[model samples]
Target: MTRAVVLVTGPDQLALWQPLLTGTERTSAAPVVLRRHDRRSLRGWAQRVEMFHKEDRLERLHELTGGWPLLVDQAHRLHTELDDPDEVLRRLAGLRTDLTRAREFADAAGVYADPLLAAGYRELDKEFADGSFDWENTVTAVALGGELEEDDAHRVIACLDALQVFDRDGVELRLEPLLRECVTLRT
Candidate 1:
């Protein structure tokens, strides 16, 4: 008989699951280059995090995508799934009509909303420009992962006015399927 035990440690489990690049099994899962984080990395990350409250700069977030809106729309769709999936799908017909008529951003305004969202959107813009928008996972990684907080859910709606990346009418927002696939990698 065997029982499952939870192991708690400060090491990266992804790294632990495979051999290092310098180790024998080069064909194993890809190696994460972070041998150890220096104070600069730690401090820089800390600074960014602290600043997130003061000025998140998002470094992730985008409501409006310039061209090939497919990816952006898909991301919005994915975000909707994160919401009450039943409602999103069930009320989508009515919501689409109402959203198309609405003129306001979806959520309440917050202090760091625009900056944080811009950070996310700008990255998306860059990716789109670089032709990387075709990959959904990259967009999701930028928007939902890396210091992403549940609180961020509210802020995205709050900063809508300034973001202007989403549909003004609100009917077109969505997330791509590829991004959804990438989300599993995080867990």
Candidate 2:
């Protein structure tokens, strides 16, 4: 059997690099040439990644960001116009508390109600913390600022999906514990 070296050049190049690394057992290459980019070529590279990058990016996102609540909270906004027929906020908050209490979260800055709170993979502050809120309390609170009907609530999730804040399935948002606290924000 001969060695096959695959060289991928681009941002979001993880996909190309993934198969090369994951299947390295099969493909014999002396240090594959996986050329990626920095901030300079970020946008273009991201486009390429989107074309080829699959669950790797999302999984990486989850792994880096502690859990999916950051993703889900980042995705949807509170619709304060209508009534929350589904009580999404309540469900989501419960989820956040659970993820936090379970020690599932990494050690994140400015997030623990007590030092006991595990801020799993908190290096992802830029991802979920980028929201307009101040902290987790505020981020989670943002959802409670408004009342939303089922359709409007879904629309919030949809908007988040479009932004890539959550996956197409919104699994990050669907987690049982987090979904239970979707209604507690007031500002």
Give per-candidate clash totals. Answer: 23, 32
lDDT of 1 by residue, 47-155 (tens): 5433211222212212121221232244346444555423333332232234331211122111123455535544444444323223233345445643455444334
- lDDT scores in order: 0.32, 0.30
TM-score, cand. 2:
0.19
User: Best candidate per lDDT, number?
Assistant: 1
TM-score, each model? 0.22, 0.19
The alpha-carbon deviation from the true structure for residue 50 of candidate 1, after best TM-score superposition, in angstroms, is 51
Error of 2 at 94 (Å): 33
CA displacement after TM-score superposition, residue 2 of candidate 1 (Å): 67
What stretches of model 1 exceed 4 Å from their correct place? 1-114, 127-142, 161-163, 168-170, 174-187
